[model samples]
Target: MTITIYGIKACDTMKKSFVWLDQHKVEWQFHDYKKAGTNKKDLQRWIKAFGWETVINRRGTSWRKLPEDTRASMDASGAISAALQNPSLIKRPIIEGNGILEIGFDPAHWAELF
Candidate 1:
């Protein structure tokens, strides 16, 4: 399976994930959402697979910086829109391969997956 890891390249969690994946010799592509941006279809698919709550980093500054109305009205679609506009709001290092989806960095869990 071809693995694709998605995140902002500058994020600390993404840096750790990069080291781990390289150390483990997992060949994968990167989607730097901050630079290249992401599409609606993939976002929707990810949201369906992982749930918006898992995909969105509500604790991040990107989310907190939003207007109160925007924050309060964040349903799945709202999350998708928000993430598209501000990729930093996405939790770091969402790794995916064929039939494989991982939302965050967990060394133990990744060891099992790898």
Candidate 2:
């Protein structure tokens, strides 16, 4: 399976994920949303696979920085729109491959998936 990891390159969690993947010799492509930008279709698919609540990084600074109204108005579609507009709003190190869509960085979870 072709693994594609999506996130900003400088994220600490993303760094850890990269190291883990490298240590495991997992061949994968890094999709830096900050540089390449996010695709609405892909984001929608991910949100569909793992609800907007799971795909969005509400704990992150990006989410916290959003206007109160924006945050309060968030629904599935709104969340997807926000994430597409600001890639940082999406959870880091979203790993996609082999019909799997894993969000965030959890070594234990990755161990099982890998």
Candidate 3:
């Protein structure tokens, strides 16, 4: 399976994920959203697969920085729109490959899935 890891290059979680993957000798591709931008179709697919609640990174600074009304008013569609507009709003290191889609970086979860 072709493994692809998506996230900003500088994220600490992303860095840890990369290190783990490297130590495990897993072949993968990195998709830097800052450089490549995010696709609506991919975002929608993530939302469909994992639910918007899982895909959206409410704990992140990007989400926290949003206006209160904006945060309060978010629905699935609104969340998707917001994520598309700001890639950082989506969870870090979304992994796609091997008929799997994962959000966030958890070594244990990755070990089981991969």
TM-score of each model, in listed order: 0.95, 0.95, 0.94
Lowest summed-lDDT stretch of 10 residues in model 1? 84-93
lDDT for each of the candidates? 0.90, 0.91, 0.90
Instruction: Tell me the tens digit of each residue's lDDT in model 2 across 37-64.
Output: 9998988898888899899999999999
Candidate ranking (lDDT, best to worst): 2, 3, 1
lDDT of 2 at 31: 97
For model 1, what is the alpha-carbon lDDT of residue 8? 87
RMSD of 1: 1.0
Candidate 2 worst ten-residue window by lDDT: 96-105
Top candidate on lDDT is 2
Compared with the true structure, the alpha-carbon lDDT of candidate 1 equals: 0.90
Question: Candidate 3 at residue 97, lDDT?
Answer: 89
- Alpha carbon lDDT at 91, candidate 1: 85
Q: Give candidate 2's whole-model lDDT.
A: 0.91
